[model samples]
Each structure stands twice: as C-alpha cells, then as structure tokens.
Target: MSFKQLLYILLFFFTVSAKGSFILIPMDETTQQNHLKAYGITYWALDKQYKISWLLNYRGGSFLLPDAQEIRKECQIRGVSFEVLSDGESNSILDEISSPSQNMEAVVLERTPKIAVYTPKGKQPWDDAVTLVLTYAEIPFTPVYDEEVLSDGLLLYDWLHLHHEDFTGQYGKFFGAYKNAPWYIEQKKNAEALAAKLGYGKVSESKLA
Candidate 1:
C-alpha cells in the first residue's frame, strides 16, 4: 500500500483520553494525490507509539481514527482527505462492514515491523523504487548485501526488500545494451570485488550462494 494509505490508517487509532469524534480518512480520491505524504505521517504516528486499525475493502480501505487536533493538523499539512464521523455514524459503518455480504475486515496494527533491503552498498535511490519509498516515508531499514546475508544479518529484520539484485547472477539483464557504459563497468567491478572479498570466484556464484 502507499504511504498515504498507511498514514490514514494510523491516524484512525484514538486513545481513551481523546474526547473528539471519530475521523474517516478516505482513499478513493484522484485530485489530492498525496498518498506518499500520508505514509510519512503514519510512520510519524508509529514513532509516537500509537496503535491503528486498517479497515480493509471499506470505501477503498478507509481509516477510522480518533479525531484529534494533532491528527487534523497532520492531515491538513499532508493534504489528505478526511471526514469527521459521529459515534453513531461510526458504529453504523462498522455494522455495515460486519455484514456477511461485505468483504471488509479490520486489521489492527500493533507495532512497526523492522525492514531491511538486500542491495549493494553503493546503490542510489534512483536505482530502486522500494528504497525510494522507504526513504521518502522515513522508515528505518538496514541494507544487506550477499556477505551480510551469508553471515545471517537476515535475522535482524522481520521484512526484507530485494533491490534490483539478481540471484541468478545475470547482472540484471543490462549487460547486452550497457556493457560498455561507465556505470555498468563500475557495477561489474564492484560486484567482482565484493565476490572476491567474500571468498567467491565469481559474482554469480556469490549471489547464488
């Protein structure tokens, strides 16, 4: 899901002390396409130790959050679309979702999962979409290479994203067109160096291992 969608979900969680009404953050919009910013806000909420419920398949997976001034400010700052719902209205929506015919379900988010990316040490954000999103969302993640994986760094993370890497060792199928390019040559050299440093004769062998 986009970061904005995640943020909208996080903003739905309300503390018992909150006195305001419930807020509904809608995701089915085209004008204000700030989903990524919403994601950053969600990460911010997670950092503040808030719990959230994700209403799946409900109005494009809308979020039900306790209405708070801080959350309102955040929504405004991020340009996210939200509506305040009274207690009765909120409960009614929940009731509708509970109907057997509806495919909606609520998933409570308790904690943020640790994320990792399996990528080269020198790869840039322009080289990978996952990394770009993670960076934009301000989500913390570790970068692990073949050597780190071989040494069991995978145990440190609950989630992992592979970044433009080929386990089959074909160099990402770009060798035919850009084999002579400086960047390609540098990439090949880096791979070879890493493989040699890790006691592998070839980059493909190390990647496969």
Candidate 2:
C-alpha cells in the first residue's frame, strides 16, 4: 500500500479512539454547571460525567423554574447528569452545601407544614416565608403538607422545621393577594383540592383561620 493510504488508516483509528474522550459538549446558554463553576452556586449531580459524581439533598437548577426544567431535560438527554443547584435565593445566607460523592445518594430536607395552617387553618404566610427563606438562604428543602408528611413519613434530611406553621386552616395569604397571577390561582386551587382529597373537612374561613 502507498504511504499516504497507511497514514490515513492510522489517523482514522486514532480519531475513533479519541471520540469517547471528548464526551461533554458545553452548551452556550447559561447552565447550572456554568453558574456553579463561575458564580459558586450549589448543585447536586444527576448522571456520571466521570467515574465519580455528587448529589445534593435539595436541588434547584436556576432561579427561574422553566430554565431549571430545561437544564434538567438537557442533562438527561446528554446522559451527562441532572444536577440540582440552589438557585441562590434562600440558600444565599446558609453555609455552602456540598455534593454527595455517590450518584443517587444525596442530602435533603423535607419541609412539612400542617395543611390546615397552609390551607384553611390559619393564614400566617409562613409557607411563603419558608419558601422565601429557603430561596434566600440557598437551602434546599421539599415542601410537604400534613398528609404527604404523614404518608411519606420523612425519609432523608439532616434537619427539619415546622416553619412556624399553623394548622388552624386560615389558607395562605398569597392566594388572596395574588389571585390575578396564574401561579397564585393554581396554587390556591391545588391546595384546596389536596385538602379535600385528604379529607381535611370542608374548606371554610372559620375552620382555616
């Protein structure tokens, strides 16, 4: 065979072998990885980029939920990892949380507030406060109502709090204040529906407050 043909064959072999080495293709849009690396955002890993990966208890990709959901889908598609990073709202004041070395293993906190307080029991705005605090403190937590908490029974978490919640049944204040907003309306309906499903008694002002 000619020297040129032999050289071409050798180059082809090397290219095939090198393909696996360059696995990750960084995206142009702002990603959680970019934020974590550039701005120090906390995050948990979803897939293995290498032999080792990390996981976090509470995961938020970006301050914007849509953006976060997009990143999650992208990571899953790439077979890279679905990492949950604190969106930097509540977790801002809290100490920086690290990723777990194991892929599935993670540190998480489940925030369970009584439904009556969040729903009909009392309208103290504690639920919103908890969410705001979690966002600001950059802490990751799963918000659960009484039924979910009782049924799921709290699995993983280093710490837990009641968030100064009320179970009297006042309903969250945001529902009234932000009724025009889609998210607010949806949240209110969902809460009411959930309460009914759990057989929390008839929804009423006197019972909630």
Evaluated with TM-score, which candidate comes out highest?
A: 1
lDDT of 2: 0.40
TM-score of each candidate? 0.82, 0.31
lDDT of 1 at 23: 74
lDDT of 1: 0.77
lDDT of 1 by residue, 121-200 (tens): 88886678998888875667788888889999899889999766667777777999999999999998998998899999
Distance (Å) between predicted and true CA of 135, model 1? 2.6
Query: Residue 166 CA error for candidate 2 (Å)?
Result: 8.5
lDDT per residue (tens digit) for residues 53-153 in model 2: 12232243222121344345544543443223333522431233333342323233222222221222333344367555444433345554555465644
For all candidates in order, the CA lDDT equals 0.77, 0.40
Per-residue lDDT value at 166 in model 2: 36
